[model samples]
Target chain A: MNDLVENVVKGDIRAVARLIRDIDDGIPGVREALKALYPHTGKAYVLGITGSPGVGKSTLVDQMVSHLRRKEKTVGVLAVDPTSPFSGGAILGDRVRMQRHSLDEGVFIRSMATRGHFGGLTQSTRSAIDVLDAMGKDYIIVETVGVGQDEVDVVKSAHTTVIVVIPGMGDDIQAIKAGILEVGDIFVINKADREGSDKTLSDLRLMIDMDQKKYEDGGWKPPIVKAQAVFDKGVEEVLEEVEKHRAYLLETQGEIDFRRSPKRVREELMDLVKNRVIEEVLGKLTETGDFDAAVEAIARGEKDPYSACDELVLPRLEIH
Target chain B: MTGKRRIRIMVAKPGLDGHDRGARIIARAYRDAGYEVVYTGLHQTPEEIVEAAIQEDVDMIGLSSLAGAHNYLFPRTVELLKEKGADDIVVCGGGIIPDEDIPTLKAAGIREIFTPGTPLDVIVKWVADNVEPRGEY
Candidate 1:
């Protein structure tokens, strides 16, 4: 077990892969490994790619990885797909498009299933990113499962979130109403060869113009790049934009700890606390049969849910 | 975090065969059986398949080939896994393999071969009975 931590820190691929699997499986004692790995993280730049299904996210990621490799950067990719809600199973096919890099020693590509997690990513996805970071990857690209109007969780963990959209399919309305649109560090019009490309481009431009005025105090404006990922065109421009965004964040933030900014750290800490409290408290309640009893009381109208919740929780609180 | 561990399998098509209908159906079958399936699209070499399997840390690799290249592709996949010290990953073959080739393939470390008309449930059940999730966790 100790050797697993050491080998992961030493960048052994097999060990790294094993640790990631263990993390995904919720194997016992992984917390210690994560604790050992915590300090080694924050070195890799995390880039998030998210969009609707069949928008060419995987292909674009494949191209971007190749371009980054050409610049001599080691890359780790985590591509997520949805799980079957009924069967508790998943078909993780995102790695299929990125198989070209499977044999590259400097590139590690992993496919993840949402596995009942909402917001386009799973809890294990975050831990897997840390594993890749500790394994010495210079850049980590997290590809969320094809998301919809919301599911903006990617922005919390990514330094640069690139939202990909195709030329048509009424995405203009989607962009207008989506919480996802607000989180893009960059927007991509992939499949730009199709018709209505000009219309889509104009719509996005108008929307950005309207939105940028609010942040016009020397803030970064998200650039829109036209791309045909399958033909390998405009990928270099996308990479260039990613680099520019990185430089912009570092310059504007006035620190090298953009990945560990105060806001992000606070969120991470709170999330850890929330998950632990839920696990411990809920486990105890369920084990003691109090949880079922409370549920039965609520179902029978003997106790309101709010009062039952407080009754169950207030005693457990350490009121200092 | 408290969920049961699920079996992960990679269904890969090695060699130049693009007839992936069999692979696709089997992948869906595995998914419906409540297993996580990573379907590596078409035209993957043995090296690519093995590397992907190890990276994914999957318990099994179901190789599909209709181009009559299973004789070389299946064993080569097993060999590469062995060379990478990942032979603990079970390797199974499907698609158009003849009865005569079964003994040689199994001798070469291919665990089981399911030829045409073999039911998907049988294959899934074989996997459930034969393979456990790999690693100490």
Candidate 2:
């Protein structure tokens, strides 16, 4: 462990931010930093917030962050936005909306761009969450862009997933596909003061009741929270429901450990293996000049890709 | 060894400067130039600006100050970054700075000061040419 890693584990604010920056840039020494800080993590409760773009997810997160802070729990927020594939430019305006916590030392807010990383999060977001966890934040909230099914990946990394829904929007409930519904541990009908709030609330309840498999492993029903986050209405009850869901998850330890954690761990391990295999094989091939020869042969029609891989690639790899 | 990565600049409004029209315009211009820009909202202190710059690991800090407090806020931001071993982060300022104060700000380590009517192309070109990430990526 280096001095910087040690400082990060000790909750040094500057060091924590610098370490996250390095990780985001894919700079060297981050592996060692993660290794040193890993033991200090797993203490923070992670919450995932997802919804449609106009559902005011940012406002809900801001209110939740304030609620957590008032309860004396330190909070860390990761607001993820999608990067423009054509321009590589992103307007990370979530921070502008959450300016209330900008000056609060107990709150740390960061905006991340999904630069080619799928599931509405950057490749560095998980690492940033770990860094925040190690930095001693009691609650870490990951707010996704919440556009499509791919954004559900945020739930895999969280202990609780809050899906925000707005009332009075045409075809609102139809947007909640099966994938999003399965991952939702709690449903929030924000903008509850709107005209069609009752219809949306009843609609969500009927769907949840019909989908029996979502609660098959346990008898816990996902609570429907009615919140007008803009006016700071019913946010406390929403927080209470979140806490209730957390308690339910704690009681169902077998499900969490066997079903959730194992799947997440396997995904992480596979990611590492895939990256390492690419790095090793490509690096060896480049060093030995076989890669170029294979490319040239394929271009010249002298060798097929299958033959090239069998002869040149298979001989060097030790996969079993 | 940045290696042709996107140049990220943090455009921050430090102190009580409520005039953010210039900063917002510059941010949009930089974005149109295909640079990633993180605009820290109004009323940011020097410490908060430095912290955000470090956290975002941006190539440059574009500070906008129109309240005649650049002497203290801008230098304090630079000083905090230096103290945190991030002196490599470029510091630039704009908005309402007088000509006489320009040399003093430069001496205090502001890379460039864009006053009123400074062309957007000049600022964009300066950042693209001068601001480089020090990270070993």
Candidate 3:
């Protein structure tokens, strides 16, 4: 186990892959592995790609990875796919699109299933990113299984977020704007060879313009790039904009970090603390018989949930 | 003891076998049994299967080959995995295999062969009873 963590930190692909599986499986001692890995993380720049299915997001990732690799950058990709609610199976076909890079040693790609995990990325995903980051990957790309406003939690895991959309999807524009507009660091009009590609680009530009507060806030303006990812066209341009976004973040590190990182850290800390506290409280409550009695009382309509929550939580609250 | 580790299995169809009814069924069975299943859609090569197994760090490689290339592709996959230092990944196969060919395949490191009519539960139980993730469990 110690050797596994050591090899993972040394960027051993096999060991890195094994640790990710261990973390995914919730195997014992993986927490220690991640703990050992934690100090070596935060070195890789996390890039998130999100778009509705059929927008060619996977192909875009493939092309972007190639472009990054050409610059001698080592990349790690996490392709998120939805787990079957009934069977827990996932096709994980993202690798099919990116098979051209399968033989490349510098690229490490893993497919993840959402598996009903709430929030942006699954808990496994965060740990997987840590593994990749600790492996010293220069760039980590997370391609969301499905992109929408609801999937904005992905932004929590990414330093720069790329929102992809294709031509001829007029009806999806409004909903996309509402859900992901604020999160996009770069907007890509993939399938630029299509008929409505120009119109789609203009529509995104118009939306960005309309949101003046996003500009007044003085953050970097998101750039819209045209791409035909299948042909590998315009991928480099999109990546250039991504690099610019990264440079902008570094140039204005304090402001961007203050605006984004602290809230993200707080949310992550709260998620951890909340789960641990709930587990402790629930175990104690179950042991003390109050949980079952409360359940029975609630079922019998004798006690309201508001009062019950107080009865359960008041004594546990610590005044700091 | 297995503990509560969720076993991950990759069900792959290699060498142009488009008939995926059996592969999909087994993938679903593993999923329903609470194991994480990574299904490589049809027409994968031996190299692709080995690469997927290594990258995914799967506990087992469930190759479903109906194109009669299992005699060649299945062992080649195991060999490639061994060459890549991932020989510990358990390799199993299911498809149109004649009774006479099973011994040679097993000797070549194909761990188990599930011919037609092999019950899904049987395969699931076999995997549960046989496979564990590499390293100290």
Q: How many residue pairs collide in each prediction?
A: 0, 0, 0
- Residues B1-137, candidate 3, lDDT per residue (tens digit)? 01245677898888987899898888878878777787777788888778877888888999998888889999999999989888888999999999999999999999999999888889989998889867652
Q: What global local distance difference test value does model 3 have?
A: 0.82
Q: Which docking band does candidate 3 fall into?
A: acceptable
Among incorrect, acceptable, medium and high, the docking class of model 1 is medium
Q: List DockQ for all candidates.
A: 0.69, 0.39, 0.47
Q: What tens-digit string does per-residue lDDT give for candidate 2 at B1-137?
A: 11135677889999998989889999888877777788888998888787777666678999999999999998899998889888999999999998999998999999999999999999989987898865542
Candidate 1 chain B: 10-residue stretch with minimal lDDT: B1-10
The pairs that clash in candidate 3 are: none
Tell me chain A's TM-score in each of the predictions.
0.91, 0.84, 0.85
Q: In model 2, how large is the Cα lDDT of residue B76? A: 91
List CA RMSD, all candidates: 2.3, 4.1, 3.5
Ranking by TM-score: 1, 3, 2
> What TM value does model 3 have?
0.87
In candidate 2, list every pair of residues with a backbone clash: none
- Compute the DockQ of candidate 1: 0.69
lDDT by residue (tens digit), candidate 2, A1-320: 38887787778776776677676655566777887887877888889898889798989999999999999999999988777777676667677667667668888888777765322143467789889998889999999886575567667778888989988864756866667877888899999888999998888898889867756856668889898898998789888988987888787764533224776788766755665576567668888999899999999999999998888878878766
Alpha-carbon error at A294 in model 1, in Å?
5.4
